[model samples]
Target: MSNHELGTVQVYTGNGKGKTTASLGLALRALGHNFRVCVIQFMKGSSEYGEYKALEKFENATVHLMGRDTFVNKEAPEVEDVELAQEGYEKARESMISGKYDIVILDEVNVALDFHLIEVEQVLELMDIKPKNVELVLTGRNADKEVVKRADLVSEIKEVKHHFQKGIPSRKGVEH
Candidate 1:
């Protein structure tokens, strides 16, 4: 029962919360099954997040933060943001092809695409070349239509209700 038999493309996207959380949950579940996972965070560049600290306990999981800690202006992203995302995408593509990991998560990559930090064509190309044995997960808001069409499983989280709407700020271990 190897995890490498029929890996598929999964996309978690929308305006709702938990897209990243859902992807992380999948990584944890995969790790529980002794699968190696690699998570490439496109627009997060800090170790301050709780998931960053918690995932350290799993030797089979690796996380790469590839952006500044500050916010990115979607209308006009900084050069650093673009560069980091490009670097992260390159690493993710390499990992997918390396066959060293059973699951590869490109966290916030959809947002990166929506904000024009990276092109959809490149992402689509990566998906095209992805090895059949490597599960690919892409997460973030505003996932492109083409990406959705390409994914084997697409989950669009709808924000029917959220604590943030009630003015509750993002809490550690819950929203980080």
Candidate 2:
């Protein structure tokens, strides 16, 4: 396959702060390769996150969030949450088919599934339907075992150290 035809789906998980960060790194890498990247921020609406703030300015990437753009309650996800998640999924699916983006990162997509905001089956279907040359990446904790099974690469970031434990709050340009 030509370099343009290289396509694979990656899953980044585990209890770590860098799941999304790693995905963003990949997105930047792809963009540097002259590949168009699309990032769908499921369950995230605010653009205050450092990556969002930086990536949103990139010419080759577009970021969109489906939910109300607030922190979620893992203990109490409502049906409306699922609906918004579906909307985000649809946007991802649409981007997958639009054939414009070379790489698509469904950031926090698995979290939506774990939270029952999106169906795992639907994600699988979308993955199956993607173009052969379109690369895909999914980021979030608790990514389904099925998803990990289907992915070409699955990396879990186990947290061994975090400054947050020492009471350093998240900051702009570093941990927004």
Candidate 3:
């Protein structure tokens, strides 16, 4: 597995928006270069991301979405949502091991781990077990430092100012 030139694993973390967007951008760029891309979106069930929709038109990209439409919170956590996220990660791990994709985005995986539905140790183990050529990405706020340390690039999107805090609800195409 170490024989091939390894790709990078990145962390897109912080309180601001666009964590998944950043990863999607990477996927898009990879796809442009004829790289096969796979995205496993956690915390998102039937809803669609515009990037996913666009990528679906291409023959090279595939998206596996798992989750219900619900927000995560400390007070009233979505137990089922987190469970589904864990299941998605299990499938994601399988895909990573299979070496079918040039790049794989485990979108919102960090959030699932933070909620205690997914084990951080298990993810770390999976990282070690991944195919070297498959560039992996884990996105969401509050990414573990251990995970970040293991990443080749770590970008934290600090929320200096956001329209959401200004009472702006999430809009289609923009937020989706």
Candidate 4:
């Protein structure tokens, strides 16, 4: 049940929800086995999320929020957005190289890449340098084909239906 073996690259991407949710679910499972986990959230720095608050209960987990509460324009991202994402990426890469965590989840990294905040080649290079036992997870919509091609496992969460279409806002403990 423990992930004590070689860690593989896992990607969760698509035009749907549950990408970050799925990665966090994995993090929770990893914690059950006493694994050290780091969650670096990109473009999602709001402290109001229930998950962010709940992460305090896990002693072996660390969550880094590197974004503002404001929305970022994908077509033309602001300078501050780019800077924040770059900082997040640097911290994420450092964490992975330090061998300080068993699982490193770069939440919303794919979106950052899609918005041109980071380059695909940069991520690809990081994959090459990752520690053998470090599990690297990238989550967000619009994942590059190159990323999918390099990952060991790729799960696309297709949007079959969503409450947002029904005018239901994000609820605490569920969508937040």
Model 1, runs deviating above 4 Å: none
TM-score of 2: 0.93
TM-score of each: 0.96, 0.93, 0.90, 0.96
Residue range 1-176, candidate 1, lDDT tens digits: 24559899999998898898999999989998999999999998989999888888898888889999999999999999999989988999898998788999999999999989999998998899998888999999899999999899999999999998899998887787
Worst 10 residues of 1 by lDDT: 1-10
* RMSD in Å for all candidates: 1.2, 1.9, 2.6, 1.5
- Candidate 3 lDDT by residue in tens digits, 1-176: 22336777888999998898899989888887888888998777764667777888988888988788666674566778767877887888888877678888999888887877688897797678877788989999989889988888999999889997789998878987
- State residue 78's C-alpha deviation in candidate 2, in Å: 3.4
Clashes of each: 0, 1, 0, 0
Candidate 2 local lDDT, 44-119, one digit each (tens): 8787777877887788889887777667787898677778899999999999889889888998899998988878
Among all windows of 10 consecutive residues in model 4, the one with the lowest summed lDDT is 1-10
lDDT of 4 by residue, 137-162 (tens): 99999999999999999999999999
| lDDT over C-alpha atoms for residue 15 of model 3 | 93
- Reference-based TM-score, model 3: 0.90
Report the lDDT of model 4 for residue 42: 93
In candidate 1, the residue pairs with backbone N, CA or C atoms under 3 Å apart (3 or more residues apart, or in different chains) clash, namely none
Candidate 3 vs candidate 4, TM-score winner: 4
Candidate 4 TM-score over all chains jointly: 0.96
How far out, in Å, is residue 139 in model 4?
0.3
